[model samples]
Target chain A: MASEMNDKNDKRGRLENSISKAGNMSGQNQNNPSPGRRKVLKALAGLPVVGLLGLQVLRKTNYDNKHSLQRQLVDELGLSDLMSSVKPVTASEGETLRIGIAGFGVRGGQLAASLGFMEKSEFDKKSAAGSLDAHISQGNLNVAITGICDVFDLHAERGIAVAQHDIFTGGEIAKKHPVKRYMTFHDMLADKNIDAVIISTPDHHHAWMTTDAAKAGKHIYTEKAIIRREEEIEPLYKAVKSSNKVFQAGHQYPQNSVFQQAKEILDRGMLGDVSHLETTTNRNSEEGAWIRHLDSNGKPKPGDKKSIDWKQWLGNSSYVPFSTQRYYSWARYFDYDTGLYGQLFSHEYDAMNQLLGIGIPDTVVATGGQYYYTDFGDIPDVLHTNFEFPDKGYTLTYSANLTSSKFRPRSIYGKDAWMAVGGDLTVTPDGRSEKYGDMIKRGLVNPSAPMIEIKRGALTASAVDAVSSASTRYYEDRGLVSTNIGGRIWDVNHLHLKEWIDCIRNGGTPSANIEKAYEVGVTIAMADISYREKCRTKWDPVQRKIIRL
Target chain B: MVSINNQKWQTGILVALRFLIGWHLLYEGLFKLLHPDWSSLGFLAESKWILSGFAEWIISNSSVLNIVDALNTWGLIAIGLGLILSLFTRIAAFAGTGLLLLYYLMNPPFIGMGHAIPLEGNYLIVNKTLIEAVAMLLFAIFPAAHCYGLDSLINKRKKN
Candidate 1:
């Protein structure tokens, strides 16, 4: 009986030990897991939590990577107030046209100088030229110049130089006059006297300044590349729309007579069904990149700084240790400028979009990099992009490089004929063979069809005739066509700027208005995104959403 | 697992490919930067293409292009250096891929059809650049850097 009791005790001890071992194993698994059935079960059970944690980690990392710099900059600058609550201002009945400039850079300075000239010229033109100062008088115009809102010091210097040069040289002035230049753009806007402002800063600042100007009830004429980032565009449009002020985007090419003629020709189907459009810019120089050549004496002295506000110069970008590279060569950096796309490509894209009557590209793809110079620049030196519009049945290829001097033919190829303006328009007719001309024309009733083999480049008279005939046919068919095509093409910039001034005087939509500018900005922004992602990007015009490829 | 001869052949092919691609890019970049008279900007500006308006502006301002050229040269040098196991293998591979993509998109192989064979006119889908980029990607993916690089030195030290 004692032996049986001992056996039971031993069995009990064994069972307790097994339980302890399992418990110890589980504890170890809390620290580390061995390959076992229990461990496997634990791992399987924890998978959902692990996946959840992983997803959170991934989301945090991505957000940090993309927005960390922007967040830091925004926080540092205390730009929260600047972004929100844009108050609309109504044009006063007898308010003088108050104008403020966001950037006091080269472009800004020129604009300021031009304004000064305009102020002096207003009286003279009214007295002598009979040129209607109607836009200036009647409380329509007033001038208030603002210093560097966002740009490097060197860029500001260039602006100063340009202003000085304009004052000395003739630029939109009947007589040179001195204009009051302010230290800060905010001060200029806050004065409550300024009527309009011209934003001549880099691409990023254009939207912000324009929005602010509109909020301040100031008319605006912003340079090309209305805005760089996609998100900023809508708010700008809204600000402009809400404030019933004249808004003009600088797209000088459309104003050009040549482009106008080309548009007319395209409308008439003179070049046949346009299938492909290719454009390229391969500038290869330091000057071409718009890097201001800075003086050896680093940052300007305090006295000089007074003349050119340094603090205002380092506007929205990171407050880096002052370097001439940042100031003179701002375009080289992606932070300040959109490089070629915003500065140069914007004009071309806008013109093409206008000519083709396309709103925004359905797909955009870009590829390039800063491969050549070891300079302090972040923007790419070479860029090749394509905007595909499936709805329009066409694609626009844009290429720009700093390296090669290779200039390829930039023309639109159509189904019937290829039209290369500045050169002859070549029209290769369909179904016109040497031997088989009549063979395929079985039962054709029209025998008097003109049999012209390669009609030499259209003469002025012939062009006029062609335009009239095409217009007649178009009218009969209920199509949009031009009857006039022989006049010389005008300078698009001259015409565009004139239109803006005219719109200010006589209420009407500027040639390159808000909607068109937005289209151009969205397309270019999509291209930049596509380049970064190495895939196609699409822009929904109606929704104004950029779909990453 | 692979034979010594096969390894040698693979290494040889890779080296040849690297040299060709690296040299081509390096040469093109150098040629542009060195020749002042021959400017990409001027050519582009003068071209009868769709974006000539902007091309003219870019051509007029070559500072941006100069920066681009400098980057291209360095990128090529880096690719060459990486391929030869000098330094930064992954960086070099990434740059090469980037450069190839840019070139391919700027002027696609299949620009205009109906002139000749569909893909014959200016259409170079599988060009030297695409091939090089692919090779670089492969090298980056595998442990090719260890075969003849500082990676091997680090591995040896660790083993010791």
Candidate 2:
């Protein structure tokens, strides 16, 4: 502008002035006003850039529209509330309940830790390994571990150490309530110091212990299978129901956030007439086959005939020699448990029972034998059990492959869609569907891919582990039954215990109360009886007993 | 200081640079505006450099995170419009430089930092972010907006 004003006679100056005035929409010949058309052209020059960008964005997003399809399906299914389904963890109110732990072994150790009584050595080890999230996330359920009973002295000692020195919640509470070691569960139940009991003993002791605890005026949280034999189901159920005590079965699946999302998907009828649920456990490892006597490096784990009270460990099960194998891995023997049915399938059954409320299958047939790992245990290495709920119009099948670690998704086969549930939940629209038929045909939903995926990663809890072995990862991921609430991944087992404690302190029924536990017990018993007899076992609802045919 | 021998061409090239940078920022703002799920969480979460603690603090609080997100989304849009229309381009350029510098400091591609987020290309200490921030500073120095922009229309300049 300075040059143009000073040297209007120069041709270069004139050229620059004309270009600037025309293209840049500035003052032309300062004394002469610019034309309206020139000003309008310059003012609208930037619009083309924005307009081109908008068109390009539309074209790009259309090509990569998978997210839109997911959004559309989620919107259609009304599953936007799935994330918020995990209600925040409310602190257990009222008096802090005094609880006793019966048979504090491996599962018992986990239960104790989840309840916030993690021992110093164990806490340090987990903290060093960066795996103390279960305790770290669940601070205090307001329940104190007053007594710990175990037949094995080593385990009892470990439990005592855990309950004594483990003071994460409050040092005052820990000091005020000193933990005691009970040689027998009856002694612990007899003591008025104990108000509630966590039955984490072997499957054989669950029914009797739960019954005894209920009779002693104590609330019970029994670990599944809940019963080993068929006769104990009704008695335990009646014992729990007759008493005013709160009973909760330790099946974390039903209370899991993933299961909550799956339940929502089912409740919405998004799957559309689900007729089958395929439950599977594929493990190719020594540990999965109940070879628990040996350590990871194939060494015999601690506990001798002197340190362990073998007679009491045998309990009501028949007189057998005190073999360390039987003592450590009791789930293998028919005298102790139903093996795969009682161990892994019990979780599958309980989850199904809670989700579908399809309880006490009319007929159950179990097949397969101890094809491998036969030298040590009676339980089969490869077992396939089919449970038919004819009235409910669906069949639940469980395939346990101890020798093969193939990834067969635990899926519910629905007519319109299939929901594969695990640590994460995914719903895939079926290629041939009555409900989503038009969606599949219109290319809005790709049938091959999962339309809706809800991933609640428990990175701190269990998702990322140092042991990357397939079986180890699978089991760890399965064990991570996490309840994520407001970006906090809670240990599902702790939530399960929290629910029980809440029921005991407050006046509400837990998710896995007596009714739910009884249904699970019957189903598990049916599967076990069928497996043992090598025949079909039918449930007689009128008699409330399992009959073989 | 640029030579006065070829003033028109210098102004022309500088104006072109302004529009190009303005176009890039405008699209960035528009893309984030269109995607509802787009959040600064992932980027802040991967903050491994100087401002990592601040980044973590932002992420740990949702309210702070929301404020940062809103400021960034709208700030880019405002700066982008200003630069493209050559209206208050110097202030826009300065603000753009400051924002870009903050992003660079949050997750600089220095050796051994090893960012988990995938980038457009492998970068050392001097990445495109640093270069773009420098370019924005140059725009402020050259005053391209006043030479041929809406700023010139509002504040017409002439020599006596």
Candidate 3:
């Protein structure tokens, strides 16, 4: 009976142990499944939100990436249209022309002196010693009168004297006839003997003076960018066309010899398929803005407006209170300037446009702000803008910053090579073996083989091994070489002036005529609109219109 | 377990944002420190129009100006650290935004637009200060600090 009781007790204990184990297993399964279900549900619920966030992030990233990539493409490539069939324009030898300049400002004065020096130097070298004297005697070439037009009475009582006796350098050209002084451009234009007129007035007056000069049958050589508004460009173009007078816009770099050489090399396909281009002008000081300092008395002096017609200065712009800052530094105000875009950027844009063979870009986007000193000025201290030409498969990135002096050397990146123009023309060739070799040698990267580096100068050429490493191992292997090209060959101002003079003397096409000037003006004006709208803008070349994008 | 998991995720997000903004500020300050030539103090001193007459006079004094410059450098570092660690977040954000606003007022982007075409010139519509201010404002408005940061840890301790 006792043995039977022990057996039953042992069996009961075993049964209790199995029951406890089963209970623990069920609890574990329930706890683990609950958490797993929770996780799955949470992940499923976040699908749309996460996907949406990712899409938005991608869009922003692509937008930012487009600029750098496009810049790289445009800078590296050369435009086929820019290499259009070249027609050499040759001028026949003719009588020395008598030229008289009436206005004197930064543009007017600079051009007058440069042209005078160029003409005198060329004449001295090319002509017989007595050729100038003979030309003057024959009434073909004479200094005539080179005096200032004081429409504003800025130069005291005496107009800026053009007579050799009146200037500090009078002795050099003392024997030449004194430049006849005129109080007004109208007075100068009225003289039938005066064959040409150079208008360097404010934007508002550019059209009026040029139109009048054309109507008077005098050739017109004018400073650019032509005007502010598209509407104005049309009228100016029409006026120049209707008058049947010779006209030239002063975008002189096109005539520069160095630029020509660069253009020639680019045309030769020295740089492979160009992909990007970038240009910048960084200025961190107020002087860069062209703000003139005030006089000690805090009053603007009369000489401030020397040779400047005050009324003509007002032109189509609204009348405002006269301040020396505005008078001397007309570029600081919107009424007289498109700020840096018109004054400085126009020059660069013309070069790029001419070189790219692209008209106003299909799209333009700009972002910038003033983060520097504040004064009476009303322009941003820093600005960055991008222009996209989809059809041309290129883009241009431009930046201006006043806060930092970091300067990026302007460059064009091509598929096979890169081209940089400033101090020298650097050509970087592309390939993979060159990059891989550098990486392997560096040990930082294990790549298959060595690379070659070629260095080219104006007269020297040398080849060196390329070390390939992970960091140095560029995805594209290319060799780079540089050569110095001489400066611009043609004087843009002189050529334009000569064209204008030639067109007047012999009716022919001017190099940068009214139509081209108008085109450039419209393009720049649209750029301003894009900036104002904070969106992309497009220009219709056929219709000559700007459409905001 | 659910509460702990949520806390961890939140902490991760807060950490990420703190480092993003904190590092930006810290980098700016450190850059100024490393490159003394990059200092704008001399520029500020030379400014004849922006600063008030009294401020200009004060800045003209070398001893006082030096102290102010040192304070500015350290203040930027402190603000960066505070934000990154989720310590004194409110104060750091406030100060950062304030500095940005001052920069914006100093040079505006509209001035650039007012200039030439291609709209390049001294304008004030877009600038670094404005961008930073917007970032700071976003940070200040969101509960980023509390999401996955020291603030959350502190709160958890308090709850326990």
Candidate rank order under TM-score: 2, 3, 1
Whole-model Cα lDDT of every candidate shown, in order: 0.55, 0.79, 0.54
Model 3, position B16, has a per-residue lDDT of 61
State the DockQ, from 0 to 1, for candidate 3: 0.03
Off by over 4 Å in 2: A1-75, A80-86, A124-134, A137-139, A166-176, A457-472, A475-480, B1-160
**lDDT digits (tens) for residues A144-245 of candidate 2:** 788999988888988888877645642224444788998888999889989999999998888899998888999999998898888898888888899999
Identify the leading candidate in terms of TM-score. Answer: 2
* Model 3 lDDT per residue over B1-160, tens place: 4653243344445446666777667656655675564544444533333544434544434345557667767777766765665555667778888876665554445543232223343444776668777777644644534332344345446868
TM-score of chain B of 1: 0.63
Regions more than 4 Å wrong, model 3? A1-93, A96-102, A117-147, A154-175, A295-309, A403-410, A422-424, A430-510, B1-160
- The CAPRI quality class of candidate 1 comes to incorrect
Q: What order do candidates take by lDDT, descending?
A: 2, 1, 3
Winner on TM-score between 1 and 3 is: 3
The residue pairs found clashing in candidate 2 are: none
- Candidate 1 residues lying further than 4 Å off, grouped into runs, are A1-98, A109-178, A294-311, A406-410, A421-492, B1-160
Best by DockQ: 2
